[model samples]
Target chain A: MTSDSRLSWRDVRDRIHEHILTGRYGPGDRLPRDADIAEELGCARSTVQRAMQDLSDSGLVERRRKGGTRVRAEPVTRATLDIPITRREVEQSGARYGYQLIRRRMAPAPRGVVAAFGLGASRPMLRVEALHLSDGRPYIFEDRWICPETSPEVNDLDFTEESANEWLVLNKPYTRLDLRFYAVSANPRLSDLLETEPGAALLVIERTTWVDDAPITTVKAITTPGYQLLTGS
Target chain B: MTSDSRLSWRDVRDRIHEHILTGRYGPGDRLPRDADIAEELGCARSTVQRAMQDLSDSGLVERRRKGGTRVRAEPVTRATLDIPITRREVEQSGARYGYQLIRRRMAPAPRGVVAAFGLGASRPMLRVEALHLSDGRPYIFEDRWICPETSPEVNDLDFTEESANEWLVLNKPYTRLDLRFYAVSANPRLSDLLETEPGAALLVIERTTWVDDAPITTVKAITTPGYQLLTGS
Candidate 1:
């Protein structure tokens, strides 16, 4: 409750959250300053600041340089999503994972690939397609492109045994990443690849990574029907 | 770089990121201790610790309590998703927002709803079905259940003028939240409600929130066809 008691920042955060939940501070209500809250709670100002930061991060409060802090009128449900490598994802689902490289070739980046990478021009890149299986059933079909200029090591490794999904994730450390999730009705080609009926709904995860402004790789992980991604806050 | 230069933790983080990006510290490789890094970077040990925390948060590294920090063998793309209230989401996308309360009734919690809330037994709950519109077209159809015991104030609000989504977010601050994203093929009912073709692919955002041990609300916001949820890491 006080600095003398040494309440952790988490405890302080919970206390502030309690005030908001109890309607002592309603939506769009400006909260007491860190110094004021610290004085009232007998805690250090820094402790209050730490608690406020956590509250803001969780979308409970909005902090402004001039306006101090106010509870958000419509707080968002903020959640952190960590998307792991495909092998790990499959294994975590308690299924035997199998992977096979469908094809690998050096080809010019397509218009969509070029736009995804924001490349000025279409360029030759390593295009790899692979299938990931769970319990011997197709789980995900991945179409990927790797920029040779940034990840030149891909040119030397054959993807026959290791998927580009796992290989690039392990070998490359991207400084920037772009991720997207959407739903698509499977076309004939996709449906055949995924062993599903045509027009089956599929979830697609598109990701692109860059290291210091150089593109590392871009991939579309098209999941099988009924795949779901879960997270918590 | 070393502590005498008084470099900030952000500078230290960027320097460490560069080392990993340049292959100085390869995947699964351990780096110098915080003390050693501090000595090398001429910063305080606490500064290095702070940098390590940020690196771990961003999925660039994994820090153990005693094993020091190592580059993740397969770095997951970590992204924070802030799912705002539906009306705000529509408006934020530069579209005209509208809400219509389709149905509201006191209904016994269904098996799925009870399981979602982790309730011991099915109980009576206020079920609210609503449609959110963007540019006069259906954007999301939400089926939600509110626990009256936890949110007694909801009984007073007529949802025809104000949505339950906005009301709950403004009034309730939950201690816990569960979120899930998946694709669902529209059934006949959903197709008619959303004005989409039958079997159209739709993105479903399911969320459950709890205040301490009490369930607050659970909702399945099924987005219209072609709706994509995007984020970055």
Candidate 2:
């Protein structure tokens, strides 16, 4: 597209970002009003507003109610991560997905589970331990706890046919989600379960969900060695 | 916040979300047009539109240009992660921040770096290794490769006083970013540098950036044990 061509919001955002990258607008420098930018670029003011909103969302700029927009002094690299159901993840990778339920029982919530849910006290919950396989090889071992008070239907249905990861994601809609990533050295038990050697480094993805301030579930998905989690492009 | 009070866009969103959570609107169900929902809720069409946009952004709904909106058939959990400059991250955590430059040199880009940048062939790049400290303890060890062709200013400035991580973030504005997280077993060299034991599991955050298809830099930030990366709340 030529410079004089009709500009989309992305085009407008790129032009504004070009100005900033060229040092025309230094750190913490105030940007022109949306109207002025629209006039200069021969685009609608709404287009400029959209571009500004995107830049603001990406942590490149800060927008104030009446103070206009300014470049962020400390720019942050913002990324979006989408964690899909393990079955979907494996299938999308062109692998035959398999799941096995290792154990299921009703037990008191552990201290870690209680802290994750921010519960007042420990309570009875359904605990599920399962393994996700890709092409008959171990992929991820998940330890999940379901709050029966919030999801009573889980108690009626056995997870032998389908994994809880797929069931809860399809049935329950969470208002809030908490995600964390860390690393752990696989112990002998975990190594045996994941079919990896002991002392191997593994990535752990911890996810906790809540629906309208009520606990839904908390899960720790420990992946086998060399597994990588990538952000959505 | 009574039910009959003037409703904001957030109120409209929560009401619609409650319907989905309560099974009133099942998966893959088409939502009413924005205008109809606005009239039923006694709000403006623009307000309903905003609420729908929020839902769509969070992976709860799918909005088609000509087909209108519907609940996502398979919901994915979406989260935003903001990785600020390491110095800012340390200071924001209420800890004193320190930086040390370990090595800086110009070398031929490695195979991994070339693949990260999607380059046609290997090229000479500026390689820098640095350590970020919190309260005099190693927080993160970064091994970075900067494309001198894209950033020529790096040739003049020595990264002794300020870290390349902080400097590049402030100076460079990338149009594209690639992020990956994985675990690594600390080797003897890495263990000595990070002051950790051998075979310790470490979290590695690899980031690659480009400015409009021109490669900028790629860095692998290896964190010490017990470090966790959390999603933005």
TM-score of chain B of each: 0.82, 0.85
lDDT of 1 by residue, A86-130 (tens): 888988889999998999999999999999889899999999999
lDDT of each: 0.88, 0.90
> DockQ numbers for every candidate?
0.61, 0.64
RMSD of each: 4.0, 3.6
Q: Give a tens-digit lDDT track for model 1, residues B163-218.
A: 99988876676777888878889999999999999999888989999876799999
C-alpha displacement of B166 in model 1, angstroms?
Answer: 1.3
Consecutive 10-residue window with the lowest summed lDDT within model 2 chain A: A1-10
Error of 2 at A203 (Å): 0.4
TM-score of each: 0.86, 0.88
Candidate 2: the clashing residue pairs are none
Which residue ranges in model 2 land beyond 4 Å of their true spot?
A1-32, A40-42, A63-70, B1-32, B40-47, B50-54, B63-70
Q: Is the docking of candidate 1 incorrect, acceptable, medium or high quality?
A: medium
